[model samples]
Target: MRTSKTFSIQFWMDTKKSKKSEGLIYARINVDQKRLSISLKRKLAIKQWDSKNQKHLGASQTAKEFNRYLDLSKSKLFRCYQELRDNGEEVTSKAIKNLFLNEESNGYTLHELINYHSIKIENTHAIGSIRNFKVTEGYIARFLKKKRIDDISLSKLNFEFLCDFENFLNAYYPKGHPKAMSHNTVTKHIQRLRKIVTLAYNLEWIKDDPFRRWKSTFDKVDREFLSDSELARLATHHFKIDRLDRVRDLFVFSSYTGIAFVDIRNLTNQNVWIGDDNGNKWITTTRQKTNCKVKIPLLFRAEKILNKYDGHPVTEISETLLPKITNEKANLYLKEIAAEVGIQKNLTFHMARHTFATTVALSNGMPIETVSKILGHTKITTTQIYARVMDHKIKSDMDAVQKRLNEKARKFEEESELKNLREKIVEAEKTKYANLTKEQLIEKLNEVLNEKSDTN
Candidate 1:
């Protein structure tokens, strides 16, 4: 037996009969002291009725649904109902029905649902995944700690919360950073929230989904990649101190290799290999971030750099390829290098990967597919960011093409003028030859010829 009301629930009742039937558990719900119960067959017929009020309780289907509703409204069946009844003002059935209809019967008040889903994900996924979920869940908990889950209605998740949380993340832990949390980071948080909310809907935790009106903050994020000129400046810049200079070189090297700092720290001479058939040396490694293997051809500059450090004993000294330095010290030196090279953009260790993708590969006219493979990007779309930045290179290429066309046009004009001069010279020779007539030449030339012959 079952009952239905503003909320729906399922209850398990112990039965005396050895053979259990559909109506083994008789569900009862009190509506102003009126008890409603439906047998197994009746509960089945109205199982789909989301909500049936006192007015609609006349029909048999509605009556059974009402009883099932009552069954679900039991003390244990209703989650967070006590809080709602205590703190919330008397809400009309129509208002509650509106909430149910708004979410399309997903069941609103999603705190429990979010937590439950987070727990499941934590159990089944990686430690990093669980950590990220807990972080997002912490944000949600702090945001709605005072309010009941049901009170976190669709309208409450406005733009204010989004902006406020962004500011919060900016001030989180670190008291002052030059900038707030990155748009991509904040967007990830929002995405996690969306995932949990979606899970809640599927699990029937909340009746209304608040995320329908929500939009991603991803597009508006300031995800910057270093330019080729900026990268070149870092590579060629002269640092005052040897320590800073070596840091710059190593960072630039890692950028060219497209490997993260952690993986770069693990690099050894063994990781470098010369191709057998082609006889070309390349760095064969995998990215720590994506765990994808990458094989990047050794540029001449890269080979030269390695040759300089090849004989150096691997130690924590500046001579080593990867001189052991803390991330903070490494980044500090990188900032100085950027400043010395007249690069206005903020420099960081991670930017090296972007620099390699944008400068060493895409800017050099290498195909994006090839670049993506070199960078070990899981998806081509991740590599498409370089394509967007490559527009400036496209413009520069157009300028080169125009310059070539102009040079060719000038050469063609000069050739045409030379041909005209040659034609004129030929015509002049023909006119000069035609001027001497044969008869006059024979009579007049006889005396001259005799004189010339005698002189000869």
Candidate 2:
């Protein structure tokens, strides 16, 4: 059971932040004699305000619009009060105001929602990913400051608010960044924002999604992968420095095995196993990103890398099969490796995984289903992203079709020649018989048939 509480609302003028002749309107909500004031963000000229009636003084167009807005606001507030009571929530000035302001009973603010979203995902999400959410938190805080508000309730968030935030992100250029955000970068930030807001909706903290009308899209990016020649060049290049040598081996290992840097960083000797049937060595682990199982047969190239670093001092210290290196430092060293080897692409650790997907596996006639499983993809469609980018795969598939068509083309030409010969003989026979009488033609045809039958 819930206690019933008295509730009422009254409109008033707040001129503190307004010009001398105009005053900002606010709705003062009263529950049990306690009061909460909500700024309507609407203003009216002081001279035209009617305090007793709580409306504009005149019937002119602007006055009529202002008065109409006040009327609707009053009716909406009353309805909100009734609904809160009907829902059995404590009827208080803040609760009523929160409800009328577009908040559910939970009454979450923007910053509060950000905090909740952070804590909710902190355990499950990676540190880098959580840092990104913090970046968004800074943006929202700055946006509120730009709008001259300390914070905003999720109820107060609207389509216009989101569009403004997106525009703010589009124009923002932090120091050290060469330019403003790109389409995909902006989309990424916006995507994180949407995810946070969606969490609110999913938790039933908000009745609606402010981003319902807002759409976010990203441009198609060409995922860079190593070609066969490039892979060979990088794999075979030896560096004098032991550090560079180890980094190169790591990158080449990923190229052969399609494992990510983070996953590789955690790999130990225990991850290896001998196959039951074929007795091949295999690396079996779960992808850190998706927590999906990854079981890839260790190719000889990958095995050679493992053997090279087997029981190395670094590996012994880390208790891993390969020497441990920070992903960042390893990639930085790879740039030098690229310059030394004369390969002309922006090389990164992840590109090695892409190379394995296309150049090392898919291009070598490995099945896509098998590739998806090896990559620990929950769905085959996720693997197809790599497939679509392989233009040579597209051409190679068509080459087989083109070969079959070439074979049939010659046979078709021979049949066409025979058809021409038959038509020519028919024309020649017509001409030959045209000069002969009908009886003579019949006698010649019968004589030809009799000779052919007797020979048979």
Candidate 3:
């Protein structure tokens, strides 16, 4: 039997149950997206095994001797593989593992790890985030089917598997989506895969990080937000459809308060607060995405919307601060709202947060730190992303400086021209008199001095 180029041999430790000092080493044989593992029956100190170099770390006698044993085991495995091939026997990881271990098998499968991870994180993560992972799982299942693969052993999932998955995502045009997945969108799927693989590595189910050499690249996206005029129009415009009005009000509330759609959906009256002075109103909640605490002073417009829906049927029934609706439908109605208001940008519920950052807050000179706090961002850099997209802010910042510079430069040029003109006029007076008698020169000089300046 012939061996495939995808075949590889690696040594890793069973560190999950090991004491801090040492761990038992195992050999993994990989071929064609499958893996078979067998213990090398050697224990090495945790610090001695350099995972990256796949060998011992230092030049000491013990390290040298241990690495020599690892090298000898590798050569023995290679000999077994060569013997199998020369004998015209089937060459597979399982076949080689059987010869090496002379016994039973134990390895984590891809789906097994995913199922474990899913069950493990089901309680901690948000439903939307869990659902998104499930959607990625579906894509993975589809990819495996397309490649005629039943399942991959987690230890055998290499860089090439990720590359194929990325290619699949790039070409995937699911129903109702406008086009194939975008660059950043494709990166997102692989990102999910990386998370899963990283979890397995951390759990000691795998030895080396399959993604060690892989790097994900993302394209910068220009997010859309409403202009002041469009926002005002959308805020004030009355829609004939009642559902459109509710969606618009919620969107406008988010635009005013900068709350995310999921967090907005989960708001309640308890989230609203009044100052001890009993004058100021506020909305306080934890961000669903970041789990960071948020406290926003309610603006007049946002408070009005809240009051308008107070004790209303939908809010009362749903036990929320406002009418409840799916994000899908809210975004759908936002399209209608955009067309009614004559705005050209493709609107999404998240853009309301962008509008708050760019048009409402940053454009109006609100400090980014305050905006970052109100938005429940853990890092100031996260808020800076919204700040970076404010083209209007950029234009306004440069406007006065550019205008002042241009005016000063023009004034200097005029002064220089005026000085040159005066010098030329004096020269002309001197030359005109040089060709004349003394009396004519004096008369011409007097006449020229008396004449009004035509340069004016």
lDDT of 2 at 114: 86
Regions of model 3 farther than 4 Å from truth: 1-106, 276-278, 388-392, 402-456
lDDT of 2 by residue, 1-456 (tens): 464466778999986777968999999998888999987778788888898888889889988888888888889888888888788878888887777767332457888888888889989987678888888888888888999999887777789988898899899997799999888888888889999999988977777788888877879888888888888887888789998889999999999999989999899988999976878899998888787888888999999999888878899899998888888899899899999999888999989888999898888889999999988888998888786346777798899999999989989999999999999999999898899988998999999999999999
Q: Give the TM-score of candidate 3.
A: 0.69
The full ranking of all candidates by TM-score, starting with the best, is 2, 3, 1
Q: How many pairs of residues in model 2 come into backbone collision?
A: 0
- List the global CA lDDT of all models: 0.64, 0.86, 0.85
Residue 314 displacement in candidate 2 (angstroms): 1.7
State which candidate, 1 or 2, has the greater TM-score.
Answer: 2
Candidate 2 wrongly placed segments (more than 4 Å)? 1-106, 126-128, 388-402, 428-456
Cα RMSD (angstroms) for every candidate in the order listed: 13.0, 14.4, 9.7
Candidate 2 clash pair list = none
For model 1, the superposed segments whose C-alpha errors exceed 4 Å read: 1-138, 141-174, 178-188, 219-233, 236-242, 307-321, 388-392, 399-456
TM-score of each: 0.57, 0.73, 0.69
Q: Write out the backbone clash pairs for model 3.
A: none
